[model samples]
Target chain A: MTYCVGMVLDRGIVLMSDTRTNSGVDNISVFRKMFHWAVPGERIISVMTAGNLATTQSVISRLEERSKTPEERSNSLLELPTMFQVAVETGKLLRETVQDTQSENGEQGKGRFTASMIVAGQIKGMEPRLFMIYPEGNFIEASFDTPFFQIGETKYGRPILIRGYDRNMSFEDAVKLLMVSFDSTLKANLSVGLPLDMMVIERDKYEPAHEQRIEATDEYFLSVSSGWSDALRTAFHSLPNFSFGQPGNG
Target chain B: MTYCVGMVLDRGIVLMSDTRTNSGVDNISVFRKMFHWAVPGERIISVMTAGNLATTQSVISRLEERSKTPEERSNSLLELPTMFQVAVETGKLLRETVQDTQSENGEQGKGRFTASMIVAGQIKGMEPRLFMIYPEGNFIEASFDTPFFQIGETKYGRPILIRGYDRNMSFEDAVKLLMVSFDSTLKANLSVGLPLDMMVIERDKYEPAHEQRIEATDEYFLSVSSGWSDALRTAFHSLPNFSFGQPGNG
Candidate 1:
């Protein structure tokens, strides 16, 4: 299991993904699920994956190879004409990778080899875009009406995002918001763990504005986590208590 | 789909359940998920149901009838000497109800007609107790280490309970805490919704200290729902923002 989120704010885009992977509770390991490719000022793209590790790793590796050696292949993620095209290419790779792996195991591969991804990036002169790509090679774009995307272990972290997200919030606050969101999932679920990868893209910059890997001991993260819990306790206490007010008929 | 929570607090027990039930999105209706039978000054027991409506309804009806007509019923729920025995009786009824339905449906009843319950109550000369009864008829008691149990569409509302639960909190505060938790689930899940039913059993009272059905327009509930959104936003902003602090290597 994994937890990843991508948000398209007015200032730009912010993306975060946990690094944990496990076959079973007894066998767990950390694996980076965030991947990105950039052409400096020309374009910048990021992909965060969830689901089967083999399928996601294969899709990302093929994408890297195609981008780095464009001449040897007809397809190149970096050479895609737009963020939408990038999503299409990435979705194609994810679907094919999953299909290839599933076909190998015959009847036993029903729901095992599936994977999904969040694609975020910008092209020169184009506004930032974010998408959630499905294992079936289909995707949806983030819009003003729905400015964020989250996948994997999303429920425990969602209420915070639904309540805290603001279109005009700064990149720093957005990251803060994601941190709280991730922290909620981290506390509730064992499948998502620390050493989270994050990237910030400023609108029209065509390059990452900020990037960091938040580890277990990151000072700011630790503070946000413990502080958020305390703040929640305070907020809960501040709420007006319910009055029995003449019990209703049962 | 449903959401029901039972908390074991020092003061007593607080139980809340949504009234929404649906076969499909279009086929939805209100069905009470909470049922209680109390013998004044002796004992109080509340049951909150989730899962197949038919199964839960049947179980509740059988329990209610047996409790009311003990002369003809050998296993009256009211005749149970201990809260543990009450849970055992309820679990037995629930398992039989589900199995009866499934057997009638033949092989097509693989995962259907299943249900779970939260049994909470107090008996004279004994402390308050809480139990989560599974569809398989197995049950576990809530203790200091695990003070609460939530069933159905539970994830969206869990973090709040996890962070805010206190054994020594007042009954009013406990209800307030449950309101917030239920509100979160109501907001995030369509299948777990409005007109929540709640009961507070103060220790040794052997009767509900209070009982109410929280409607959508119930002034206090409305206040809590909207107030929670505001408080969460404020809390999110109160946390310090993140600093990228020199980009990390990819």
Candidate 2:
């Protein structure tokens, strides 16, 4: 299980992903699931993955391998004409990677592996875009009605997004909302772990405006966790009771 | 899909259930999921069901039918000597109901249908108890570590329970927390709908201490929904930014 979210706001785009992967209860490991590509001022694209780790890693590595070779790197993320094209190329690679890996184990390559990705970024001339790529290599771009996309362990964190999201929200507030959303998910699920990778891209900047890896001991996250708990306690106490039975003296 | 939660606190027991049932996106209907039987001063039992409404309704009707006959009423809910016996009787009825329904459809009687229930209440002389009964008829009582049980569409509302639960919490506080949980589930899933049924049973009392069906137009719930949205937005704005960078004026 995993949790990754991408938001395309007026100010910029925000992407965050947890780093835990588990095959079973006893078989758990930490693996960074975010990959970034940049061509300085020309373009900057970040991809966050969830689902089968092996399939995601293979797809990302194939993209990287293609980028290293001058001939094959033309259609790479760094050279893509637009963010939409970048998402399309990435999804094709993801589907191909899952197929190649599953075929090696004598499996049919259909049911053995399934992975998904969130592609968000800016190009030299196009507007900042966000897309959620499916395992079948198809993708859907975010619209004003749904300015964010979340994949994996999404339910626990969705309410915060639905309630707090605004089309005109500043990038700073968006990141904080995403943190609270991620914070809620991490507290409820063991499959999502820390050293969370986050990136913010200012619209039309064509480069990452801010980026950081949030560790378990980060002071801001610590404050957010304790503050939320305290706020909930306060809110819980403030609500009026049933008041039916003479405000029970017990 | 459905969402029902049961909590056992020091003050008493709290049970809440949504009234919507959905077979698919196009096939949704309103059905009550909470059932109760009271023997006045002797015993009171409330059962909330999720999954396969037909199966659950069958089980409750069977119990209701048994209570109608003098001889059979001896083994019925109203006559259960203890809370534990009440749970066992409910579990047996649930199993039998599923078997009868599935066999008539020419499906395997054991695994063809899935149903989960949260049973909570008290016998006149006993402390309140809460039990979660599974499809296999096996049930587990809530403990200090996990003081509540939620069946159906549970993941969306689980985070609040993971951190907000407290056995020493007052009945008012407990009910508030349960409402927050239910609100979150309602926001994230369309299958869980309005007009929630809630019951409160005070310890040592066999009858319902307080009961109400929260309709969609309830003023308190409306306040909760709007206030929660504002609170989340305010909280999001108060958090620190990436900290490593200046406010990206880019």
The estimated TM-scores of all candidates read: 0.94, 0.90
Q: List the residue pairs that clash in candidate 2.
A: none
lDDT of 2 by residue, A94-189 (tens): 888777777776746558788999998888777888999998899999998889999988988898789888878777677777888899998888
Docking class of 2: acceptable
The models' CA-based lDDT, in order, is: 0.89, 0.82
CA shift of B143, model 1, Å: 0.9
DockQ of 1: 0.58
For model 2, the stretches where C-alpha displacement exceeds 4 angstroms are: A66-75, A99-112, A237-242, A245-250, B66-75, B99-112, B237-242, B245-250
Considering only chain A, what is the TM-score of each predicted structure? Answer: 0.94, 0.89
Chain B TM, per prediction = 0.94, 0.90
Query: Which ten residues in a row are the worst by lDDT in model 1 chain B?
Result: B241-250
- Per-residue lDDT of model 1, residues A142-177, tens digit only: 999899999999999999889999999988899999
For each candidate, C-alpha RMSD in Å? 2.5, 3.7
Per-residue CA lDDT of model 1 for B13-116, tens digit only, reads 99999999998999999999998888899999999999999899889888867446657665366778999999999999999988888899999987789999
